[model samples]
Target: MGSPAERYTYPSPLAGFENAPPLPDEKNEDGKSFKNPPRDILSEAYTTFPEPLENGRRGAFDVHIYYFSSNKAYAKELWERIRREFPELRIYRFWDHPVGPHPVAMFEVNIFTPAQFGAFIPWLAIYRGPLSVLIHPNTVEGGEGVSHMDVERRNHSQRAIWMGERIPLDLDLFYAMGS
Candidate 1:
């Protein structure tokens, strides 16, 4: 069996597809194979939410991540993986059922912190999700706009400035980022 990391590589067609296997050249009708793939998982939860939140004495810092993906399965997969790895992070869903909308799917996912937001990065990239983060380094005393920052697509990694003041925010900003 593949490990959790392996599961992130890529998913394949499961049994019981909408149409039978096709010949190399057969183009039936819908113009795509899984043109409306079935929904797999529609819900999620963190292993450490609600509790730590209620206990209060928040983490040193946190951030908000705003994103939209064109692929539903990919978004869902990323969401699940993010939850499994960083249960302390909270996630809110807004575009699960509208992938086929006019301009394709415009999903909104909010991640509360690196403890939770970082894990979602891999999935979002694989699923083609837009990434706009409100970063707050745990120890950095200032946010006078970073100096050297750029978003990379080749290796699936990049750096962007937080572009804000030194004042920090709590779960609300982060919770809102992912939305």
Candidate 2:
């Protein structure tokens, strides 16, 4: 093995692009140029749901719902599946939105009846998979005061997108933009 000195040598610039950052002045006053926008080196971008899923005032007897999915197609498939399997449950998504980079679906579940909401928990426990990382707050409200931000890169797993005659069980079948 090489000495620790050699192994832990400080990071040095790559051969050609040493000390280089994208040039900002490479564009015109029309504000339309550039191969790509400047990357967010010191920043982590953020995005909010298309709409907040909320219910009536707080009370043990109040309706309780969840903004369940950030992914539209998954949400629809799940909802349709649930509706068929469990026809008695009352679930609805007032606002349907798809957030890029997030494959999870989200929709507020309107629990207009507390008793019904209680019943929904059992089914949720069983069906909740990786998607269950989603949460149902006691009160659905603005994220400003919320302490947590759960952001995940899109899952390019087998189930990522549903298209074509055969459901792709591998990534090689998926389209990579401009394909």
Candidate 3:
């Protein structure tokens, strides 16, 4: 094993793009670039999503609604309702086992815009029924390529916005990767 102070490194995925043009200079008065930059000539129109974090630090928040595999019937019904009701939102297929950072079988809903979030969360708050929901903002604090799952687990109860029964997550996967 390496020393605690030893650093780990991986090869660059964009090794050939060493001479790529530098990012455009900031246009804002503060000299900082925003995630959703001001509208430009190329793209004059776009949807404005609320920045989950201040200073445009993060993009969006992920809302995962978890249901036991055994409760597939009810979960399916609810999932369909969600689909029909929110056709414009991005919803993923339900997984029987833990996938991504989730510790239980769950279907994911990506809330890109704050308006969507405002509309959806209230409905979920009252209508989720028996399902447990895990909502976390997509922010990277430590470094790039670090999974939010690690940060979630560290502050599992505190960081996440949980709605129901909190299941134990297989956090080993995240720890192993960091090692």
Best by TM-score: 3
Give a tens-digit lDDT track for model 2, residues 4-59: 35423233445444767755656566668754455546322122121122334432
RMSD, every candidate, angstroms: 18.5, 21.4, 11.1
lDDT of 1 by residue, 72-96 (tens): 4545666676667656654545453
Better of 1 and 2 by TM-score: 2
- Please provide, for model 3 over 39-111, each residue's C-alpha lDDT reduced to its tens digit, 9 standing for 90 to 100: 3354211345422232243336678888886777788888899899998778889898879557778888877
Write down the RMSD of candidate 3 (Cα, Å).
11.1
Clashes of each: 4, 14, 0
Give me candidate 1's TM-score against the actual structure: 0.26
List runs of model 3 lying over 4 Å from the truth.
Answer: 1-59, 140-158
Model 1, position 128, has a per-residue lDDT of 37
Candidate 3 collision pairs: none
List ranges where model 1 is wrong by over 4 Å.
Answer: 1-56, 69-73, 92-130, 137-179
Better of 2 and 3 by TM-score: 3
